[model samples]
Target: MKCLQEQAADGTHLLFLAAVYKLLYLLYTKDAATVDHVLRHRSRRDFERIEQSMQYVKRNYTNPITLKETADELSLTPEYFCRLFKKYTGQTFLTYVNQIRLQYFHSDLLQTDESITYLMNKNGITNYKVFLRSFKEAYGMPPGQLRKKQREVRDAGAISARSASSSGND
Candidate 1:
């Protein structure tokens, strides 16, 4: 890519970073949505409050956290905090909390045999419809279908491994 060559002229180390950025730029250009999403992740000024809010969300996502409470912690009014949070994070406070909850939900979904309803409750995801929509948007499939597919893949892998071992013995 032209981007990489420009960086390569600077130094060899920069060439690797240039390649990565070039790929990222291509991805960003190909998908308008990705460009929007990536732009939101850029570091902004007054990031201390944003970082604090993110830490609070990470620590308290399993519980019911409110915007007012988070704002109060940062000595900002709810309205100002809401604006600042959205400006820096590209998502609403509630949506950020749900994203964290969904992350843990996804991990537990793959690692445990618990029921989805129980997992939802544990993750503080109260609205099934919204959660389902968000889940599908994030994962490209419904939870039940994803779980079923993973099970089938795991079972098939085990069967293949067993066959290989038995054939080796023979």
Candidate 2:
């Protein structure tokens, strides 16, 4: 609560709330042997390669990215990389990249006053048709409208947090 109170001053406490949920998941999962069994069944090298590929995507999602390039960078064939990536992460490479792009768009939309076209172009999403389709598919709204909706949500959350804190003081 103290940490929340401190971060609340800057309206950044929601990020900490997400961390709290993640920590709760780690604490509430089943026994160590179940964890050990799962860990023992998966190849560490394969996981490492996938982790490397995810890091690559996070760093380069704003650029033109392809499965072949990521596979080659990870020293795996495109087919193998696709199979492994789908099995482990359950998203096609392009879908994953688009999801990352959407997340970036969402954050920037909430923080900046840039137009949707500008934000999409700045994020390397060149095709307006494709951008609109994917952005709507992921967020259930078009980018321009999504920005407005997200801003309203964030503003409401900040107001609620402030009210709760002020009332507690009294």
Candidate 3:
């Protein structure tokens, strides 16, 4: 794909590009005409179902949701849902939920002066030990350390701005 954009092309290249596009379209739509009903439907349905599961997770991340509940929501068995979630998202179900909660927690760290425990609990992380290990693994430090570093950086920037402004006044 990058090679296609590397250089200018002439008439033969234009023809080749057209053929490639037609081939891609056929592959995506299954038929040169409408739909193939057999292969396309199965793939499209599975993709849509997986997308629906992801949206469900995003909506309910701040609440503790179970694998059984999510699987039930999509009318799939828990075992099958686990496999599908792993296949599409490249992580197990709980891992994905934790990632979402961690994102919310990280945002709150920057935006609020809340306690670490409070933020973690608010993000639906009920286990302190698990949260500590996961946070350290993902961010390369514990939440408290990350928070302190961010504060130091913010304070330094403020002090620099004030010094610059005072110097300009002199």
- Using lDDT as the measure, the top candidate is 1
Better of 1 and 3 by lDDT: 1
**Model 2, 50-146: lDDT tens per residue?**
8999999999978999999999999999999999898879898788888888788778877899888788876768778887888788779887887
Question: For candidate 2, what is the lDDT?
Answer: 0.85
| lDDT (CA) per prediction | 0.88, 0.85, 0.86
Select the stronger candidate by TM-score from 1 and 2: 1
Error of 1 at 17 (Å): 54
Winner on lDDT (1 vs 2) = 1
lDDT of 3 by residue, 51-113 (tens): 988899889887888999999999999998898889877899899888889889999988999
For candidate 3, the per-residue lDDT at 43 reads 69
Among all candidates shown, the one with the greatest TM-score: 3
